[model samples]
Target chain A: MSILLNKDSRIIVQGFTGSAGSFHAGKCIEYGSQIVGGVTPGRGGTTHLDRPVFNTVEEAVKKTAANVSLIFVPAPAAADSVMEAGKAGISLIICITEGIPVLDMAKAKQFLKTHAPQARLIGPNCPGVITPDECKAGIMPGYIHKKGPIGLVSRSGTLTYEAVHQLSQKGLGQSTVVGIGGDPIPGSSFVDILDLFERDPQTEAIVMIGEIGGSAEEDAAAFYKARMKKPLFIFIAGKSAPPGRRMGHAGAIVEGSAGTHASKIEALKSAGATVIENLSEIGSTVARNFKPVVA
Target chain B: MKLLEYEGKEIFRSLKVPLPEFGGVIDKPAQINSILKRLKKGPWVLKAQVLAGGRGKAGGVKLAKTPAEARAFAKAMIGMKMATHQTHGQTLKVEQVLVEQGVKIEKEFYFSVAIDRKIGSPVVIASSQGGVEIETLAAEHPEQIIKKPLDPVFGLLPFAARALAFELGVPAGHIASFSQVATTLVKLFIDKDMSLLEVNPLVLTPKGFVALDAKIVTDDNALFRHTDFSKRVDIEASPAEREAKKHDISYVGLDGNIGCMVNGAGLAMGTMDTIALAGGSPANFLDVGGAANQERVERAFKIILKDPKVKTILVNIFGGIVRCDMIAEGILAVLKKMKLQVPLVVRLEGTNSEKGREILDRSGTRLITASSLWEAAQKSVAATGGKI
Candidate 1:
């Protein structure tokens, strides 16, 4: 089975009446996703994109048996919306809003752990995920994706699209692709998705796209070196960008902890991951690594 | 946004955190006498209020034993062009000076509250040995440093604060005030939406623990609620970068010969990497975001061309949510709006990218088009005569 999403998953839209919510939800439905209902606080008993709208996610889940939530709530209340979905027992919450306050996310993450232990959150500023052909739960362009054995995870949206399009060009299809968001704190880490990708029998190889930000890539490398049995390929962005170098930067500098591009790349490479030298060559590199593929 | 020393101290002052007696702030040397008149001291510290760090080693900070000395130091500092290791070779002009009463320091310790991404929470970082070279201290004597992770939601609790003060060996009589300092730091950190709140060399004087230096960096994304500090642009960036911020584009200036613009942040960074690998130094990192329409692309081009070092421009766009033909039209419109001296290499991909490429090819401009980022990087670098 494809990880996290499939044709059987029933999805509901939060902030369903908003322009972004309505537009993307409509696109998801057009792509053959099972959009059963929606949740907008005041506009219950209405119909959006031919789906019934409920006032609360709890009510929508109870009535439609919706297990997933696609949230397009604005930044100020985006974290609250995620928590609301988590508390309502929605197993998977995908937030597409950007510009959320870091502390607000920290609190929302804490709430998710303490109150809604069963729920999983994906992004606050990401492109979302697609299981290709079967389902599209995010704002990603759906037509370019094809179902295959390659599983992908990234911190960026368009860059994720680039990898997928390149792979699709080389006749490589993906089992599942996820954008875990590029914020300082994300709802899920690279390891979180890697765990799922490794266990999915359909996913034979994994492509991880990371950038110079948090230590998530390093953490993932640790997990891979110890536990992963599948082949892993990786790319870390921002290698050419300047880093914040200052003696005063030690203000926040923990003793030996760093998230520099060199450190992330070196870590993953040492962990036996094939580091692509050029971003545009990711598809070709994976193609060469995976032999006898039919185009 | 990074807050200057005086700005950070103002927050500390408002929060009632322990601080040395404030003499006053002055921009001119003549104004120093008035501030010196109010403070009770023989020697005062004249700190140049420049955004650049490493002030002590750069002569931006000086001690004045007399009123005349203070004025002289202020005169020398006020309008001084400061270049530090942190400024990326750019000079930061000192426009203000802060005067504070000198205190007898019995000991110095490092204390800070910052978002520790590794631990996934805010943490209390302290060290018995602290100074300008704290990083050096960390490398040599790691055990001297004490780091405690705080509750991400509630912040540092009282018992945690008490334990920290005791562990740091605060005097039993002053442990309560030390705990108060810890509490106020977390309070200000969360309330102000600060990414980092650092009080390096938290001095222990006969009076009490005073934050001798305060450096605060607030989360730029959290500025919607912090409208008082509503400036989302980085104050420390170059002039062109500040201009890009105003136009809602992500731009960072670098010292290279080839300038590049792309659609997304990660892709923009990757473009720079490709440029570097292709034997060209990328002059800047610029992302026009998903909606790279006519006006926005035009603004981005103007910003990129401002740097005198940028000899050639590379435009890499991967149409995701936005269509390729629309961006192609935008680039064409930009060419019409402005005259270009630098050679241009454009690469378009994703949705309807072939149509977009065809539009550019037929536009009759001397623009080179590439099918991929690798080819675009090579062409742009070659256009620079492979000199870089």
Candidate 2:
């Protein structure tokens, strides 16, 4: 009942011959994801992890009927891989590659808009998404996630893992955990994932982890205020970060007063979402805010 | 990376954009004569080459009516210390000065092309209320700024540029030249993989529109394609930050006592926030990145130890793609090789965390181990004599 991915999802690994693609694709398979085939431009007709490899995404899709494409291409070619997947009619594309230029992503966004409007691109610099025990399509540690009712979305990788770890420790498992990435121009937004989480019947409550960045968090706050019906808890990191310096992530920069932590926290609080100040307080706050949903 | 004014102008010139005649860079007072010979005539502008913005108001820019005045200004500016609001009050050393022919401005217009993250496209922002403060213009006269989002596929079309120019109050006679400037700027932005290309006060002189000031920031990630431009990266970063950059790690120097090293940028920042929440300030922010192998961990440790203000070091890592035991080994190797004067707090989680903990415990080093981020922050803060 999770959104975007589940047991029926047939995934194909793009850049399958690379070290990162093969390694993580094998791990995803170990966690019960349906990885049917792979795509590597010149390495077609070869096989990796006992799956057939094709030259292009179109060939892979046609041969194996792959519904989703997981990208592990390097930064220089990652955007083209995304465009290739979208043009090939792959509905869901999860890009795990980091360091893609912002201009390339800008072009890819436009390309997707005109070429494949139905395709949903998750991240160009993220850990991808997972539907708990049913399927995994990212670099997240598989053991930490458990199939349950809570939905989680974040702009971070390990921070999402931290939230999931705390939630699992508190006996609250997840329905789906989506890492929308920390890039300045991500394919999906907080509002986009929030809309999906709200529609998923299995998701009871949601936890959003955001940081100092663009107005995505503020926009999400506005969306929640206007349309959301379920309870949501949020944690915005980088409160102690100095202004003007990029705090690790490319998108996590405090330019003037636009992306400051104070403004984001204020926006979320005024939108009726309980914003936790400390990272360790996320679990306790979420637990206190929501009562158990009876089956 | 942020390019100096001269470097940005050189890029614009290469792309055939109209700019003020160059008088060359004056690295020393003696070079002023050579620069003056290259210029057309009198009335030159001496601009200090510093990475910080708002140089005009900070007196980093000066106008000289004669060659002697230009030489004197260059001598005064070179080897001087200047501070700007962008630099957060930190004084930057001016190593070079740019001497250029000053233009008679009939009008000033603000024009910039930058990747708009909100719209997921490249946007060209223009305003007739040019050279005054762009931030103030944006804040007060939002309507005065006309923004046009450019299509990456076909780029900014002539009609679109004409519309933007017309809306920006470009004179009917000057719209064609303005459109040419806009089209060239957009092409430069795309071809150069620039994150930002700004021409503040694109002046309209008797000769037509000329770029009076230029600021171009190339994307560091896309530097692979621009090999020649990558060599021009500014040397304004701190030594430790420069070293981290060499190793492909992210490091930002801070004024605190606890040196925090973590994997993943978001988690690194979260670790810093947690350290502050535990009543301790962080000396710096260092992200060893996702693949924290032994070499990277060792390099990160060296960078952290280079800061003399650090009294305690906290290594908080959540191993997802990175193995925890490998990081533990790297730490042990660093401790064995170097004479560490500060207390070290190591917290490892995720893959092979138990093995990582066992390795650290068996190393017989004087190190504090924590099972969680909170515990690690508390230990590091207490070790640094801070209340938790």
Candidate 3:
């Protein structure tokens, strides 16, 4: 079974009237997501892509019995959407929007600690999650994904696609793929997805694509060292990026002390995971490292 | 984007943080007299405001004893382009001359609070040996650097700041002063939504602590909150980069001419390296994202065409979420709108891949689709008829 989403999981879309929300929600629906309804504030009671719209998340949840909420609100309102979804008793809140202020995320994180401690947050700026061959959510290209044993997760959007393409070329399909996004203060970390992959029976091995930012990679390394059942092949981006130049990813910057490509790579290497620097090397690195027994 | 010292000082001043008196910006030779009238002090610092490092050694910062010398210094800086590590060309950003009484440096100390990606909290780094490069100091005198991790939940507390200050060996009474600066810096950093806030050479003056130089780099993603500072960005950046931004393509100008265009940042960088490895130089690093429309394609092509050195255009798109036909449409649109002259090579894969190639092949703008990245680079280099 997939971790966050599956065919039976009912979901609601926040800010579904917006272009990104509608476009992705339509695609998710086409891929057989159980989109019970949508919430677009003033556009409530209306319908988007044949799903009923509500003004507030609470109202949508009460009516639709939606267990998960996918938020596609703009940057400024993304944190509020997360809080709203959490307060509405939705267990899983996936934020697909990018660029929410870190301060906002900090405040929202505090709120989540008290209000919705049981709820799981996939991202505040992530591409959300997809249980391959089960259910799809977020804006990932749906065509390249196929059901397999490898669990793929990344901090980048298109880079994940690139990794999946290479994996597909190698005849390695995916169990699920999650884009954790590039925001400075993302809700979920690599370890969170790693735990999910470890528990999922279908996910035998994982391909984690991290970038040059944050200590999340190190945290994931710590997790790997402590007790990860599956073999993991990881690729960290922005190795050649100059110090102080924030790579295209918002979170990928070498500032103060923690966010650098080298530190992340060193940490992962010491943790017993095979670390591949280049994107092209991810598949080969994984293929060579993973024994058939792991799958 | 990083702001110059003067700009950072202006932001500090706006936040009601105390700073030394400053003079007006002098853009012309004639504006020197007025700048002199604005300065209350005799000895002033003529600092060139360029977005780069090593400005101090480039003769960008100098002490002028007289107003005439300050004016002359301003004149010398005006219209003179100075290159720095952060800048590519001679950046003409010396808008005004800052005339101020230089503070007496009792000791150079460093302090900065930024997002620590490790714990996802604001990390405060303080060192007794400040002013110089912290990296160097950390390597040489590792004991001098003090690392204090801040809790995102509780924020940077006063006790934590004082403890850090005490660890840095400040006296009992001076701990309060250091704590004040630390707290103020943390506030300013969080309030401004800055990605980095560095006070190198935080000097110990007779009056109190004074910031000798401040370096601030804000997160471009959070620029929407600070429109005033956003408007002040240097518009003189490479034309292609600016144009790519307009169409939402992540583009950075490099000194090459293969005009490599790819669909992802990782793929784009990989493509750039593959080109370089294949003896072809990439003109720029352009990531059109996984969703490339005709408008973005036309914009990418226009930006590529703007580079006269671009002899061949290499378009490599792994069409998964983004279809190949859409990429082909964008390429054709760019070719048609720009009236195509450069030889173009493309490698399109995934999602209606063959149909996309058919569209490009039928376009007749000298398009060639290679089977792999190596083939695409070889074809692009061959099409250029020389090493790019």
Candidate 4:
């Protein structure tokens, strides 16, 4: 009943031979992700973690029938990897590489919108997504996640873990956790995942995390206030972060048109979602919002 | 990052944008005095060259009537630290101050084209109310701001530029000039690989349109293409920021005592948030950026240790793309290399995490291992004697 990924989803690893790619792919496999194969140019015929590798993503997809691709390429070529995956008909692509050029993403987004509108991409610099207790994608750890009804989505990875661990400690498990990536431009938005979470019957409530960048939260706020039927607990990080500096996330900047922590917090609060300013408060907030089930 | 008024003027001049006449960058106070003496055009503007905004309000910009006064102003600014809305008032090299003729503003207007997250395109925002805070304008008089998203393929069409210009109450005759500037701005944005090009108070002079102030921030990730533009980027950034760039850690310094380290930026910020929630301030936001190899981790640790204010070190690695044992090796490396006796709290969650904990447990580094972020923050705060 979770969204995006489950046991049946076939995954492909882009840049599978590189240090980050090979390492995370191995971990994803260990976490029960159906990693069909991998793609690393010039490393064709080589097997990593006993998965067959191909020179191109198109060739890998053709042979392995992989539907989703998680990329770990470095910044410079990261855009091309996403584009290649999109062109190869990979329905869901998650890019875990950070520091991708904004212009590159601008063009990539443009190309994605036009060429493959159905091809969903996650990040060029993001933590990816995890459908807890079933499959893990990107760079998130699998041990901390447990499957339940609460859907967790965030822009920060470690903060996601912090929140998840807290909820897990409180006996509140998650249905899915998606890191939309903290890049200035990401593949999916809060609303995109919210729609999925709303449809998943197992997900009774949601925990959404946002940072100070872009008006995505405001847009999400408007959507939630107008039509969101589920109980949503939210946290917006970087409330005290100074303006202009990129902080840790490529998208976490408080500058002109972006990053007024007050604005994001106020907007989310107005949107009817309980806003938790501190990471430690997310679990308790969600626990209070969601009624306990009696056996 | 913000370019100083003079540096902004340089970018403006390169774009063939009209501005008050200015000469080259001059460092020595005597050079500024000579330049002031040679100009002899009544009172001139002494603008400091820095990478921060709101310099005018910070007294970074001053008008001097005499060459001696200009020299005094230059001298005062040379070794002086100036803080602005965008900076911490760190002292710059005072390489050269621009001596330029001051413009009498008949009208002030705001014009900028930045990437709009909502529209997912570069949006041109224009307002007739210039020189005033755009946020205030947006808040109080929302109608004055005109936003038009530019297509990445075709860019800002002349019609869209004209529309924004017309909405700014630009005269019919000046619309052509403003449109040209707007089109050129789009070109400059694409060519220079800039994320933002702001000209607040694009004043209406008796002569024509002149950019009184310019704020241009190029996309750092696009620096590989804009090699020449990269050369002009402010090299006087904080030592930790500069060092982080070398090791690929996206570290930003803060005024706190706990030196925090995390593998992802969101996590790093969350750790900072958790520390603050626990009543401890984080000294820096260091994201080792998924590279938890010993070399990168040691480099990050060294950079964190450079901050004399950091009383304790908090290392939280989720170990997604990076293994935890490798992180352990890095902590040991930092412990051995710097011999840091500061209180250390380490939290590892992910692949080979137990091995990572084992390495730290046996390293003889006397580091605290927290099972969770809560315990880690408490340990870090306690290590700082609970003040931070």
Best by lDDT: 2
**Decoy 4 TM-score against native:** 0.90
Candidate 1 per-residue lDDT, tens place, A67-156, comes to 999999898899999999999999999888877888888889889999999998998788888999999999888988988989999988
Better of 2 and 3 by DockQ: 2
Candidate 2 chain A: 10-residue stretch with minimal lDDT: A286-295
Which run of 10 residues does model 3 chain A get worst, by summed lDDT? A239-248
Per-candidate clashes, comma-separated? 0, 0, 7, 5
How do all the candidates rank in terms of DockQ, highest first?
2, 4, 1, 3
Ranking by TM-score: 2, 1, 4, 3
Task: Point out the higher-scoring one by DockQ: 3 or 4.
Answer: 4
Better of 2 and 3 by TM-score: 2
Cα error, candidate 3, residue B262 (Å): 2.5
Model 1: residues with Cα > 4 Å off, grouped in runs? A245-257, A292-295, B231-234, B386-388
Off by over 4 Å in 2: B37-40, B386-388
Q: Write the per-residue lDDT of candidate 3 for residues B39-58, one digit (tens) a residue.
A: 65678777776666667766
lDDT per prediction? 0.85, 0.89, 0.78, 0.80
The best candidate by DockQ is 2
Query: Clashing residue pairs, candidate 3?
Result: A141-B321, A215-B117, B25-B96, B26-B96, B26-B97, B131-B201, B256-B283
Stretches of candidate 3 exceeding 4 Å from the true structure: A239-243, A254-272, A275-295, B27-43, B57-59, B63-97, B149-181, B277-279, B381-388
Best-fitting candidate, scored by TM-score: 2
Q: Residue by residue across A39-126, what tens digits does model 2's lDDT show?
A: 9999899898999999999999999999899999999999999999999999999999999988899989888999989799999789
Among residues 3 or more apart in sequence or in different chains, the pairs in candidate 4 whose N, CA or C atoms overlap within 3 Å are A97-A125, B26-B96, B82-B89, B83-B89, B280-B388
lDDT of 4 by residue, A55-163 (tens): 9999998998888999988888988888888888889999988778876787787788888777988876667888886788877777777778898888887777778
Per-residue lDDT of candidate 1, residues B1-388 (tens digit):
7888988998899889988889888887898877887885768998888776678888898989988888889999999998877665778889899999887888888988888766556788997676655566677888899999877777888898899999989889888888889888998898888888888879888877899998888887778888778844456767887788778788878889898888877788788889999989999888897667888889999999999999999999888777889988988888987889889999998888999999998999879899989999999989999443
